[model samples]
Target: MATDALKNVRIRIERAAQKLGSKIVPDWMLEELVEPEERFSISINVKIPNPLNPLEKIPKKFKAVRVWHRKPDPADIWKGGLRYHPDVTLSDMEAHAIEMSFKSWIMQLPHGGAKGGIAINPYEWSKDTLEDVTLQFAKRAIKRGIMSPRIDVMAPDVGSTKIIMDWLRDYYIDYTGDNIIGDGVVTGKSVGKGGILGRESATGLGMHMALQTFCEAGEICLPKKKTAIVQGFGNVGSNFCKLAGEYNISVIGITDQFGGVYCPTGLDIDKLINFASANKYKTINGSEVISPTYMKASFDELIAAGADMFVPAAMEETITTSVAPKMNFKVVLEGANGPTLADADNILIQRGIQVIPDIYANSGGVTVSYFEWARNTRKFHTNPGILIPDNDETSVKTALQVMFKKNGNALIKVAKKYKIPYREAGYALAIERVAPDIKARNRMD
Candidate 1:
């Protein structure tokens, strides 16, 4: 399956190149094109070796590429996220890297994606221990020439947070003798560390917008009989729930690492947020009409909870062949990249589920990260003061407003421009723009 995804990605790139009448892109360029595949493969292989282990087994030694330097050349910065999961792999990072590159192109970002992660249970690690691990990872990545603030950049991803990002970035800074010039090497930093506002909610906001776009296109009035089930309630899931409520969509079910929650009537997001906030990290499902029911269950149960939309914000491979056939939803908005495996995707597509591919569906976080990268580069070069202090949020907000402001016009425009799915339109627009840039660079050389 991993090999197949990589092959498909390669075919896509080659087809894209052919359309431009260029020789096939170089292998190195191909790497950038399908970086996420490499990362996903490595992650899945390492975390889940066999069927017996399932989700319980953990890898003994998690491999990672890290680096450390006192000073570096100017063209080595890269950035992306680091995941902590039993199933993390280099292929997973590779897949994300490719998207980061395309996403950067879509937004006209100067940087590209470079993801990293460890195959371990983040839940088992303490803060101090995690910091130590981060520093070690940073040193290793730096030594391998796989990381730099100069060319490749990094941010937080699954099982990682602002604290981890701060620790990793600080390690880089300290190793470089406080190279103030390259602080932007690591993004998703704390606010004081130059991180942008709305970082936490950026992905969720984008998912909501994508859903809104999807809804407006079909003329489906939301929250009318609409109910949603979010598989993961961390930053992405919770934020998505909040935004969905704002749009008047009823999030009837939500789950976390602990358990699942459900209600017949709409669940009050504010109440759920407050309850989950205090109860460690458990699921909250209770209401006057539906009564409270919480228990330890598989993530698949959430999908079958009978909602209009099922959002797999949890992790990759959550919805598989066994699960997709049972899901009863109109649309599946992939909040997490690669959430639905290829086999499941085929099943869901045949089952009439509108599967929003991750490449376009989950691009919001990276889109904003691109904004941060743009701001950082401008500040770094002091290049005509091109840094955007407030434009990232404003621009995306405006674009979304345009997308949803008038449902009728937006629907007609989207339908007429592309008779395909909304997800395809979003990705096609991004890919079309990026392909030209790649071609222009080749021509210049």
Candidate 2:
């Protein structure tokens, strides 16, 4: 099955290269692209002794897998996220790790790609139970020499949160006998736990920056009152909406897993944020903020509501071939990894809708993670009065602009030179950056 998946990915890469009218890919590049350096799977068993029934201890078993698509350089700077989902498998981890490799390369970060997650329904586990399981997993990973600040940095992903990251950090520190660099071993921690200031909203801000840069390069004028439809009001989606005002983009429609709300005149982002904050970030329901103007909508309805831009910040493969043709937005900026499947790329291209690839569009989180990791490695304690500058909103925004400008320009150059969709062009550019590194290290020879 893994071989078949790799073959399929290679076929897509070949097709994309052909469409670009570029030179044929070297055999070594194809080989490196289709294989990962390492894959590890571990089984974690956590015993939760029932207080009511002291005689019986329930043992929950979780299957976890981590994949390093490309090993870190000598300095050992590698990055990825850890998710807790019931359906996660080794194959999924390997594929996502490969995507992370491309994402990091596109951003020009000095890190390779790695990803791991456990097959457990986080919603079903008690907070204490979850922490125990996470600690157990961290212990096993550290014993295997795969979890550390310079080796493999873990962050939050779906079904995971900052609290879980804090637990991971604590467990790692315990195991390492209070290593000073332990805090850097896991990112996405709460501000009180050594996390960077602007790390939370980095991805959303990055998306906005990508949109603005893409528009300027295309000579497309954003509507004076620019409106957007965001699918998924999770961390990325909500933060995007929260910071939309910076770019003069108003979110007219937003959705969660349960349902959606739409207002033609634009819903109040602050009000929606307050409502979600008060209600566990669920759908906006029938609140007065959504009163007469806001109407409940479906996923399909919201996507086709004819907004100026559509941001799919939700799950992967959401924008499939069937849905791509019906999408009415002028532009589609992916805020989630692989939100649009491979086959859907041509369909959206035929409709003349530009897509900002996730590799470049949703890289804000990793960029900020890099910043946090850098802070951890710096010698801030050398002088008592010296303080490390905080990564505020303005600094994050500026850093993202620089990153977006460089990569966005590369996206355009590759797309125009190869005459392919932006997604394929991004893949080509990222591969160009990464493949050479592997060659330089003589790993692909």
Candidate 3:
């Protein structure tokens, strides 16, 4: 499975480079483009009381990993998220890390790519136990040089949150005794704890902006019709669904990891958001209620729902070879990283279904995260404890310009220049930005 992830990224990188050829992108850089610079993983055992046998203790091992696809120069920092999910692995981290590099490069952030996450189900563990294990991960991570403000900046992802990030930040401050830059060690902290405003809805908002821009430019007319299916109701998916109606972009069907509600006509995004938020059965899946306007959806029904656009905000490898051919959408906006498999990508390309790639489409989270980092680091020499105000509307708009308008225009330019699709143009543009060799080659020409 891990190999598949890397292969998928390799396929993307090679294809992107193919458009430019060896003259502009040298052959030697392909190895670096396809492989990570370094990989580190740590696994430690923690004991929990056996559920049936309360007196007995059970030992469980948890793994946390970081992969650096593009190691930064001496003065730069490596940025990524620390996800807490059961399915996380080293290779998955590597693939996501490479995507981070691409995302940052295209966004022109002064940072390189890295990703790390610990494998654990936060729902199953008690808060006390979760905090203990998290602090343990933090102490060891800092000691081993796996995490630092400049070395590797952490953010929340998947099963992570602001509270968990706060715990990690405190531990780093204790370890380094540097009260100044400690908060900068991690973004996504609560605004009172040095987090930036608008971090939560950044990714979804960014996707919404990009999609709207495409519609407004007469690139796609789906927004006028509002026919779309949103997969995954987490931060990215839910926020996206909530904001789509602002542009009259209607979502006909939506699903989570377990199930969701589907309506042939547009479903009410606000009502769904409220229900999902109040749902106690976990955010992704809950018991469903049927109505004349909407019906409880099974996973199959949601995927089978036809629409002009598909927003996959759930997980990686969602659109497999079989799933790809069955897709009913004309455009796939990747809200989740690596949502489409390599073969699925080819199928989509062959079918003329354009993909708004994840590296560019869903970059709103990191884009706002960069805002948090810059804000936190700016106060490093001053009183670090002073909480910044949560005035993020302006910041969110700035992110829209950087991600949707600027990067979106750049992708169009590259696609036209190379006669390639947006996905290939995205990767090629990232490669062109990160590799100075292109400029050197162009000069020699």
Candidate 4:
């Protein structure tokens, strides 16, 4: 008997297909999409031992879960993010890993999908204690042979940062005595520490590219001053707004966890960014700030604000069925994973609101992570004296633009040929790419 959660996932999948006016996808594909090849639960003690109580050697234990969606290929490469959220669960990890696999396939990366994360709010831990927790987790994973440069590479995700990624890499290097391939073991590090340039802005850049491609394909001429409303103000949202400004897309309304700011004329993204930077990147209160033109608004008000584009960059399932009908944007660009629920997708399609699916829109991070991994691996294999050209912001940006255009064009082509929604078209294309490998490995029924 399927659990209620499993049943809900299946219903969502079926609803997605129905929205596209297509039958449910293959059973094998559906099975592989939800099941993990391997799962791991790790428990580590974060507290120090007390000499007074010798019997209490083990302190408070922090739990974590890791999942690999499929066995690594011949090169033994698997890639994913290491999130650190209080609500991290085994089921969530599995679902996220599966989506990573789809994302990798859509981007045509050779690596399989994997995810690992500790279930703790990093804000509660001191810097030193957080480092210790990260080190213990890495040690356990490395001991199990599930984490390495050529095996499983990890990047930052929700509640994780470049600082934490640097810690993971440094700890691994210290453990392995400065191994040659150490840098490739983790990505999203500071550029000075062997991280690639433009990695920080990759996801947002990808979102910009996705929206551009979507507009061009639909023959919808964007306004002279493109307008947008963003639902999240975190790294992804802020960076996305930055890129949008560069592309002439003025963000008129923006929201965070607390509240939002809206302006008909448009908010100065750079000034807003500076203000948020000074205030710990919290919610932007227009009234409290120097800008009287900006008014405080609710998240729903921001979403419903008329704009050229609607971007949900925060959490999943934010656009529910009821919320979908109220959205008044030319298109919805998914900057976060599963931002729109399947039921909402049907409503959006009926309303002629196109959605550039998360798998296609938010793939920039992983794509650039692949670039960093390749660069590191190349450097590791080459002679130290040989100077391999390092990738810069321009090169990374150009490569991402090319990829976004290519994939976006392919997705539009599929959608037209099959007469399906863009989301379904993306899934079909990704499944087509991954199905052959699964069949070759004799995983098909």
Local distance difference test values of all predictions, in order = 0.60, 0.78, 0.79, 0.78
Q: Give lDDT for model 4.
A: 0.78
Most accurate candidate by TM-score:
3
* Stretches of candidate 3 exceeding 4 Å from the true structure: 55-58, 279-281, 284-287, 379-391, 437-445
Off by over 4 Å in 4: 1-26, 48-58, 71-76, 219-221, 285-288, 379-390, 443-445
TM per prediction: 0.75, 0.90, 0.91, 0.89
Q: Which ten residues in a row have the lowest lDDT in candidate 1?
A: 65-74
| Model 1 misplaced regions, further than 4 Å | 1-62, 65-77, 106-108, 144-146, 217-225, 274-301, 379-428, 443-445
lDDT rank order? 3, 4, 2, 1
- The local lDDT score (0 to 100) that residue 69 gets in candidate 4 is 84
- For residues 1-445, what per-residue lDDT tens digits would candidate 2 score against the true structure? 7533333344556665455333334665566666778889989999987778967888868899888887435554678989888878787677778778878877777778888899988777678789888988988999899898878999998788899998988888888875678889988998777788888888998998888888888635568779899988878898899999878987888876778888888888878877876774355654444467878888788877779888998766678878998898888888986677777878888898878888889988987887777777674454242233466767656766787788889878888887777778877887766555666576544
Give candidate 3's whole-model lDDT: 0.79
TM-score, candidate number 4: 0.89
lDDT, candidate 2, equals 0.78
Error of 2 at 398 (Å): 1.7
| Residue 329 shift from truth in candidate 3, angstroms | 1.4
Candidate 3 clashes: the total is: 1
lDDT of the structure predicted as candidate 1: 0.60
State the lDDT of candidate 4 residue by residue for 1-445, as single tens digits: 5433333344544544444332234655566566778989979887755569855644777898898886424554888999888877777777677778778877777778888789988777668668888999999998998878888999999889999999989888888876777899899999877899999989999998887887777634667788899988777898999888678888899887777889988888888787776664355655336487888889788776779889999876788878998989987888987777766778888888878889899999998888888788774333232222348888788878878888888888877877878777777677666666666566453
Clashing pairs in 3: 226-250
